[model samples]
Target chain A: MRFIDARCQLGRRCVIRENEPVTKAEILELMDRCRIERAVAYHAIAKEGDVKAGNMELLKDTEGDSRFLRQWVALPHTFGEFMSVEELLKGMKENSVSSIRMFPKTHGYSLKPYALGKFMDAMAEHKIPVFMTYNELASEDALYAMLTDYPKVNFIISDVSYREERKLFPILEHCPNFHIGTGNYVVHGGVKTMCEYFGAERMIFDTGLPTGSAAAAVSLICFAEISEEEKTLIASGNLERMLSEVEL
Target chain B: MRFFDASCRLGRPAAFGEGMPWQTDEILEIMARCHIDGALAYHIVAREGETQDGNELLLREIAQIPQLQPQWCALPATYDEFLHADALRDAMKENGVRTLRIAPKSFAHSARPYAMKELMGFAAECRVPVFFDYGEAPCDELYEICHDYPDVSFVITNTAYALNRWLGPVLDACGNLYLGTGNYVPHRGLETFCKYYAADRLVFNTNLPTGSATAAVSLVCFADISKEEKELIAHGNIERLLGEVRL
Candidate 1:
């Protein structure tokens, strides 16, 4: 089964399995071993606490890789896109990069709807998919309300733990643009439950390995009691749709 | 091979993770996959929200499934338990059980050490190991209780995430305390846990259904350790320490 991971981390802190840097080849090789086809890669910890620096590092490694769709990290709000949002978008176009991811917990920023209001506006205007780190369901509701109103924008949240996800049940039945990464740890019959609640279309297979969760998520994906269609949707289809949207 | 699972739950709620109740079928499947010969399962969280009755519900299940050995739930700070430790002792003896499990979070060791002490004294006399679930337990006095009673054995769950700078002192001070691999999430020191704590002192457990059984077992069974150490931690050491002939 082809798997498109929504959560794959970059840099050398807890990303490596045995205290070594993760080479892209080794990563893809493992993906093949685990049956993951492609993934959107992000920087680890948002770079020296400077998200722009993190974006640079993320872009640096994944820029030329065909298997990965590089998710950029920046809030041109503070880092002020090297020129303007237009110039930044143009540069990302030139670099063949696709989306922007925000790490509120690790980035030390407030993702309260009011906080991300303007950033959400700018991304919506440009048709950019905003990747959010796992905050909480209550907060996700606030973000989801805004993004759902803006039909052009899609937001993906990753790193949610098992408990934080239970709070999502009420809202998951309603919202569609919001995608959650399975790096959320064990949700009990996590993969099974997610497939039941939302078709595998929204689910993304990720290995927040070494630091995130056990390297067991891939196995969970393999073992989840769901159809091949749902597995393909989680493993690759949704990410393909997102990557195709940000075509260079 | 006598199997005693210091950590096992039957009706693992969804909030804990995504799964239906770990009915006997699920347990048997996990047993086949992980090669857990037998388990002394405890229902960690009770839907009824009452400790003794929740224990009763679990015990009732154990009664039906003769393959499962019931280790009664021991949530301290119960006024009834405070008054009736003798009755509790008698009940356990009648059941032919060797251990009583307690979630330290339920007892709040920092706020009430006296109650914890009383419970410890009672368990020591009963000759049953008291299991404590220690995920983000945030307790210092609980360690003090373990230090105070060298003869009493306490099972500390979630040791994988329990380390901080304070770990060195905690490890040095804890004697009768043993470790359980209860964290569903993997940690950095897990492979080292078996070696540093020694296989003799740790039990192979998964806060199953909530946590991945395959993940926890894979970490220990395939760790960069010897086969003897693996077998010892896998089933032998827990058997020796608990002294129960697991069915």
Candidate 2:
């Protein structure tokens, strides 16, 4: 089945291990091998170095590459250091970017309504999904708060390890907009269980590529004990629908 | 593409997700579904605490099941609280148990030679491969244990991503250290590991009941490595290690 990676990092980042896929060519080769038709990619510089510069770097790196759907790393515009909501939306439309990723913990911003009320409001208005790793939030409590606070906004949290099922289940029960990125959710029979409880629509297939395992990510869906319909939705359909819904 | 899971836990966990496969039948169903040929399973009772009792429980649980091999949890035999080296060896030999697992941190013991010399020495002498989670002997402790028991094959499992930086140096320094590729999900993790360390040091495991067998097997099957290398990682390396067990 065709796959679309929901989370991927383009461009080089610090702490690259020996023989890891770094360049666009290497990443594309892997995506092809894994049958990933396209990847929603954000810039590594945006995550690790400079947010604005890295988002721009993502555009340059993925320029003319149809295989990459652009995703920009967003920062809260405190003191006008970053783009205002209007400017951000305008830039996203101009660039054909559909999704936004944030690093509230990494960027040292508050997820409180007071801190991101306007920005999240704009995201909710545009139907643009926001992405982050499970670690980017301080706790499951913070994650619950964020998801409940922005009930209309879609949030796809990735890299949630096997240990947090108890903590995450209640939140998944309460929050319909909280989707999980199936990159490194390596809990045994986890996908099947999630589908059983939360339904297939709640999962968005992702290979935290260039850093996370593409083979493992795709295999998780491919070998899951769930139905073909569930697999199809998780493999690409859910993410495709989410991206297509972005008004920006 | 045959798989012999190098690390799988048996019995119920203290806490588990809904519908997690923990019983022998449930585990067997998953193993069959995933096309796994066999598994080396340690009981949760043994791993959680009661090393000797858990070891005995493992023997009883897998007595009729030929696909599941017993992997006993070991301790330092402190104050005769556990089995000494000789009795442990005899018991393992009689029961056809070839592998051993330890959790120094959980058992509240130092991994140093002063505490682990007798147990590790038995493992070294018999070529019985020792298993432990990365959390049991993490980072510097991982290196120290490998260095201390250079003769024994040390397979570290449940190593999530973010360990390559710390693990790379250990793999370089210790030839006896083997990696359990259960959840070592770094991008191109197996491919990169093979590039640097060779596939012989990489062992395929599922950390089953908790770790995903589907993900583990898929990681090896779809890895961008040679068929020969994949074969070595999938079962050949682990089979070789188990075959060398003198016990």
Candidate 3:
């Protein structure tokens, strides 16, 4: 089966938990063992206070590789690091950065429209999808403002808490452009609800590896008892569309 | 090269995230994909509040199986349903339910030393081992129970959480405690579990058809240790433990 790991924190294994290190090479080899065809990995560099540098390192590792392409997780908040969209676009073309990840809560920026409006405009102009991290709808108007402004730019919401799941649907209904990524959560009945509500089309498989595993994500999708075809979509097809829509 | 999927959950598979049904054929296929020899599956049927119904169904299914050894779940709240001691023994023993699970959290009962002692004495007298549900932060009483009765063995799932805070203490308290490689916290913490304790105390578990076979295999492959240790934790230890249970 061809599988793509849609999300990861470290490029290589580096104690994603406390002391469990998994290098990038180790990750690929493990994916190979799991029959995974391709995987999209990132540096949890935002947590390090150097988002672009982290993404640059991520791009550097995947520069020559055809199988493992790069997905840049940028902190729009970390704009002092980059002065121009030209450099950002150049990085995307040269380094193959497919998506930009936003951490409104993690970075402590108001995900409110007034705070993110100009940022989303910048992201839309560059034509990169903004992957939102662990969300709380408390900032709904601000988040939706970006969605309406950059409806073309994919808004992928993530870290959907496994406990309070019903909130995702209404939030999803309002933000038509938002897709969900199930990261490191193990609450009961979360995935079943996602497959049931989103029809597996909007739901993409992500294991939050190092913190979790690609096999965990895939097995979760597979164990949902959704048809194998639905599993294919959750594991691969939805991600393919995300990249395809971004014209990557 | 056999597997004992000590982390099997019998309810709807999607409840845990894996969408596959918890049926036997699905399990056999999963074990096959990962080169698993065999699995000892446990069912989680508390959604309808009938943990025993889940056990009965599992026992009926694995009655004659040489591969699938049903690790039965023990819900003390259901004691009244058992009615008599012999009837309870038949329910546990007749259809191949050897290992009994102590899911205190699921039962919503804070574990007590005496409660576990009484229950474990029952299981041990019946010649069955007690395997606790795979949780990291087991209540104070559960530990008390283990310390009180060393003869009873345990299969601790989610050892990552358990080890994070109490690695040294947990290992110190129960030498007989074994780990089930389900969805534990740090994927490779088993290395520490085996290193601190003995590899003999660790078990090869997938929580399969539900837990990631590939991920479980990955932890075995990527863990920073020797092939000897890996062999023991991945296969040998579980085999030895199951053998002790006369499986």
Candidate 4:
């Protein structure tokens, strides 16, 4: 079965000193080796560098690569460097971007509704899928508040740990629009159990490439005890649908 | 590909009602479905109840299944309800059990060199592989134990990812020390580990019923290492370790 890596990073993360920097070629080579036909990639430079410059670099690096889908990261409109909500949304639509990841903690901003009022409004109106790292959405109370406040925007939790079911289960139960990437969701029988509860449509494959094992994540979904149909949805169907159905 | 799971539990859990309840029959059935050839299992009761009862139950429950190898939990020497070093060794010989596991945190005992000198010495002499969970024995404490007893084959199970820095020195210094793959996913880690250390240091484990057997198996089966290394990790290394048990 083919796979689409919904979560991947380009460039190098400064925090990790041991691993070598991942280039666009290596990411593609890894995809071919692992049988992942496509990927949604974010620039690691954005984690610590200026978000605007990082996103631009990501665009330039992936300019001709159709297999590599672009994932832009942003701070709130509170940070004027990215500009007004309308303009940012317009730019993303022009670029055919389906998703935007947030690094409120790393970039030093707040994801609270008040701080990102216009940004959240734009996301909800366009039905854009917003990805947030575990550090940014650390508290369930805060997550619950954000989900309740913006019901239309699709929230995809990224870089979640394997042992996050205790916290993730409750949020999954409460929010309908909430989705999770499979980068670190390594609970025993987690996929089968989650499919039983919420169905396979709520999950997507994310290898957390460059920082996580692509082979491990891909084979995790492949070896899951769930049905072949559910595996397809998780492997690539759901992500493909989400990307295709993005309301521009 | 066949897998030999090094860390797994059978029967009902004593606490931490997170994982689904499992028994020997259920674990075996799951293994059959997942293509795991065999498993070394410890009973949860041993972890939660007295060591004597847990070991007895483990032996009895796993006796009927040829694919299951029972592991005895090590208790402190001062504890009367549990067997001391010599008696425990005798029991293991009689029961045909070769592997040993410890839960120092749950038993509320320190695994410091001073606390476990006698048992550690016997384990080293027996060439038995003693398994310790990540938190059960702190990295520094384990380093000291491995240093003190180089003859003993100390196996650390369920090490968290991103602990290469902590494990690097330990792996470099201790040839007798081994790591199980129950929770040892570290991003191209298998290859990187093989690059730094020999492939024989890794043993196949799933920490099953508590962890995903499929996830654990898939990590090794899909790793970019050679077929020989994969074979070694899958079952050969663990098979060799278990074969050295005299009893």
Residue pairs whose backbone atoms clash in candidate 2: A211-B187
lDDT of 1 by residue, B216-241 (tens): 77767656777877777677766776
- Return the TM-scores of chain A for each candidate in numbered order: 0.80, 0.99, 0.82, 0.95
Error of 2 at B181 (Å): 0.7
The deviation in Å at residue A192 for candidate 4 is 65
Candidate 1 has an fnat equal to 0.00
Model 3 ranges off by over 4 Å: A1-248, B11-18, B46-48, B63-65, B77-79, B83-86, B136-142, B185-188
Candidate 2, after superposition: displacement of residue B146 in Å? 0.7
Best by TM-score: 2
Residue B95 accuracy (lDDT) in model 2? 97
DockQ, all models: 0.01, 0.01, 0.01, 0.01
Range of the 10 consecutive residues with the lowest summed lDDT in candidate 3 chain B = B160-169
State candidate 4's TM-score.
Answer: 0.51
Model 2 residue B220 lDDT?
Answer: 94
Candidate 4 accuracy as lDDT = 0.81
State which candidate has the highest lDDT. 2
* Residue lDDT tens for model 4, A144-188: 778888888888887777787888788889899888888788888
Candidate 1 TM-score, C-alpha based: 0.46
Give a tens-digit lDDT track for model 3, residues A94-150: 667777765645543344333345556666666666666655334555556656666
Question: How high is each candidate's interface RMSD, in Å?
Answer: 16.4, 16.3, 18.0, 17.4
Task: Give the worst 10-residue stretch by lDDT in candidate 4 chain A.
Answer: A75-84
| Cα lDDT of model 3 by residue, B172-224, tens digit | 55675666766664645666666666667767677665467777877777778
DockQ of 2: 0.01
TM-score of 2: 0.53
